[model samples]
Target: MTEGETPAQVGASSVDIKDVDVIAPNFKKRLSGVTSTIVQLVPYQMKLGIRIATLGPGLPAYLPHIRWTGLFGLWRPPVGRRHRIWHARRNNEMLAGLILKYVLSMPLKLIFTSAAQRHHSSYTRWLIRRMDAVAATNSRSGGFLQVEHTVIRHGVDLDLFHPPQAQDDTIAATGLPGTLLVGCFGRVRHQKGTDLFVKAMIELLPQYPDWTAVISGRITPENKGFADSLKAGIAKAGLERRIVFLGEVDDIRPWYRRLDLYVAPSRNEGFGLTPLEAMASQTAVVASDAGAYAEMIVEGETGACVPAGDYGALRDAICTYLAAPSLAALHGKAGLRHARDTFALENEARSLNRLYEALIG
Candidate 1:
């Protein structure tokens, strides 16, 4: 067994631990973007009978996962293959896989998926260099990588996130005020442009009294003061009732459906998924030119794309849709069609499976 792994720690049943084709490792205990990707993708892969299993902490128990003790079994040849695929999305996972393949002599083929848009450090570059094959979430991300890699954009689960049957009833059920709703959902922080979203709402909500705005996300301890400051600003404008802060919610799908227009004003991102989620929910989006948002959004069709960190441009984009509700509805319908036709979750799973098959062959 690997260091720190004991027989008593093996959580998987003996039957569940055997004959795994792909080992998706998530080392972080916290739920992050990387962890979310694993959580979404693995189940779909398993549904296709891929024999995939996750290795690490934090994933939901419902997902098929083996414990640390399962690492010992990797020393032997995988069923019907010389090596199994170790898909790592983080630096630590790659390092662990490197040790298992080289130091411990496990029959494993390493695959690293990168979503970072910025330059990589020397250490990260070295780890990436050792990978047998690499996958980038977008074309821009692939350009930043020094090594050759396939560009595999992320896809949303169309079944889970879709247009609501009754939009008004859905919003009224939540008990949030306003006939019309627009939202910016994600972690409330400067980098995420949460403040900009609030500022834009303050300026615009007064003219459109029938409409309201919402911010749904967490504010960490360090950013608690920042959040308080936004609340203070909203109170100062006397628009607290109109612009609501839901904080964090368990399921964000309902929130997306309730929104007539969705805004992702992030200053930076690593393949942001919020816009895609909104689109899949048949909500028109106004996203900043961050991450792969521009790639995902079709200007004037699916949604509008604004310059990052420009609140004025963001304000104007929101106004354009607010003034023309029909245009907004048209965009929403187009977005739904675009999301289903282009970004289906099954497509991504099948593509990855093809890659795995090619590598194994």
Candidate 2:
């Protein structure tokens, strides 16, 4: 359902079994109870609960079963019938809710993966207020509320994302070796600003011959052509040696380790995780002058913040950093400190745990 729809209109039935005897205290653990039995147990079930229950054996029967789940006061009336709002933009909308579900779902006590799901129109707000609480993935998201919300920082795994004292193994994979590595890494998609970065790199490389552009990440089949286009631009500008497209790698920490700088120039964001990761690795960053970057970057104290798609400005910003390696080092160290204090895995986990406890309590 679209974010603009009402609870019932969006599929949130006003018929939540108000007297639920068995509420899954923890959303993560309760998620496992995907059975018809779950619906039967709820004294007063919500349509959302019914959706969760009917996944296994109920799936075969539940599609048709939902038609009759909301009859007039059936004693056990559709025990777990829920009207849940399910939204996706092009099937893979990158919202705060979606990111939280993917990144922290395993350890989470609750799940709410809808980017700006809460930022619906006034009509939608009436529907959303029915929920007990709203969980926002970041301050940018959480602060925007018609009601109460809990802000939880999304994070990376410290164990697997180990930074190296030496350069990462990813350099060999990136193929832009022996040069000053100024890189961008993530899912090689439009939102990451691959096009803008490529343009910036091309404009800057003539003067800074040794500087490299390492675009690392997977180019989905739909966007592989975009990657090709980037390659063509690199060639046309005679920047083949300066730009490297490491299609996709299993581990990317090495790429971060090898980088002289990391850049994220997205046009918009709820919170950008890549810069935090780069900072955690003691790498300097040049992120877009858009949402959440202000929370994470300093003009030149922690990292540089460049405009989203301005190649000329990005090139100049890169030059500013390149001109002073010591300054970059100082900013990188500051960024690392900020990331640790604000976005580290432990800090995130603790913040999440508090949210869960509040939810359960």
| Candidate-wise lDDT, in order | 0.88, 0.56
Number of the top-ranking candidate, with TM-score as the measure: 1
Best by lDDT: 1
RMSD (Cα, Å) for all candidates, in order, is: 5.4, 12.3
Per-residue lDDT tens digits for candidate 2, residues 200-274, read: 888777777667778887777898888888899889987787788877776567788777688887776656667
State the displacement of the C-alpha of residue 183, model 2, in Å, after optimal TM-score superposition: 0.6
- Superposed Cα deviation of residue 193, candidate 2 (Å): 1.1
TM-score, candidate 1, is: 0.95
Candidate 1 regions off by >4 Å? 1-15, 167-169
**Backbone clashes in model 1, listed as residue pairs:** none
Worst 10 residues of 1 by lDDT: 1-10
What clash count goes with each model? 0, 17
